[model samples]
Target: MHETEVVGLNVQRRRRGWPTLDIGPFFMFFGIAGTDHGREARMERRFEQEYFSNAVTLHLASALSPGTYALHGLPEEANKRGWTVGPQGGNPTGHLSADGLDELRGWMRRTPSQRDRRVRPERMLPPA
Candidate 1:
């Protein structure tokens, strides 16, 4: 089966893994570092480390309207795509289908800050 490897920030990675349907053949990885900035370079380094032939990485910076970042191996394709992120359409290998890419593009940031925050009930006093 075809696969499009997806590596996101730790929190983002976890959020998608649990309580969510696995999108197609997309695989997730975490702890690549340099996610806050220089993500493209980091992604390239990661690609080299993993030796992926047909894989894509999605780094969500804003997670707002259009803060999504998709690094590409080709400049021409990247220019043609415009602010859009993810793999090119009609990928036979299923590295990333058009609809799946669109789904990824529509994703929004669930966390308020760079790091994933959680509330702890243990820290709060018991109710009166």
Candidate 2:
């Protein structure tokens, strides 16, 4: 999926205080924030990042919003690369099945536009 689409979904879900869904190859992480008036509020936050390879880390990070995100992916990848997942960089909550991925793909299709307005440049790329 496009990076902008992931960010849009994250922003939308965060605004609603819903948990973000992170779907990775071997594992998945779900983040939930606290809800308090202070900076540490108890808000439910859940998001998913797929890590097929080391390069995917950069790709996912670039796509994510500026904040602490829950990462999910293959355990072998994590072990070999010393990577972490989950709210506290621990274990994966669950793995996204083929059906789940299909559902997420459907959600992406249903979204209006998949562009990150914040990162968009004033002028089009390629000097258009």
Q: Note the Cα lDDT for every prediction shown.
A: 0.30, 0.29
- What TM-scores do the predictions have? 0.17, 0.21
Tell me the spans in candidate 2 whose CA falls farther than 4 Å from its real position. 1-94, 111-128
Query: How does model 2 score by TM-score?
Result: 0.21
lDDT of 2 by residue, 9-124 (tens): 22111123344333332242345343335322322212222322112222232433232323322222222322223343322222343344344345445545743322211111
Worst 10 residues of 1 by lDDT: 117-126
Which model scores highest in lDDT? 1
RMSD of each: 22.3, 18.5
The alpha-carbon deviation from the true structure for residue 20 of candidate 1, after best TM-score superposition, in angstroms, is 38
**lDDT, residue 116, model 2:** 32
lDDT of 2: 0.29
- Residue-wise lDDT of candidate 1 within 33-121, one digit each (tens)? 33235646655655433332223343432221322222332232321222333244221111333343444333423344633321111
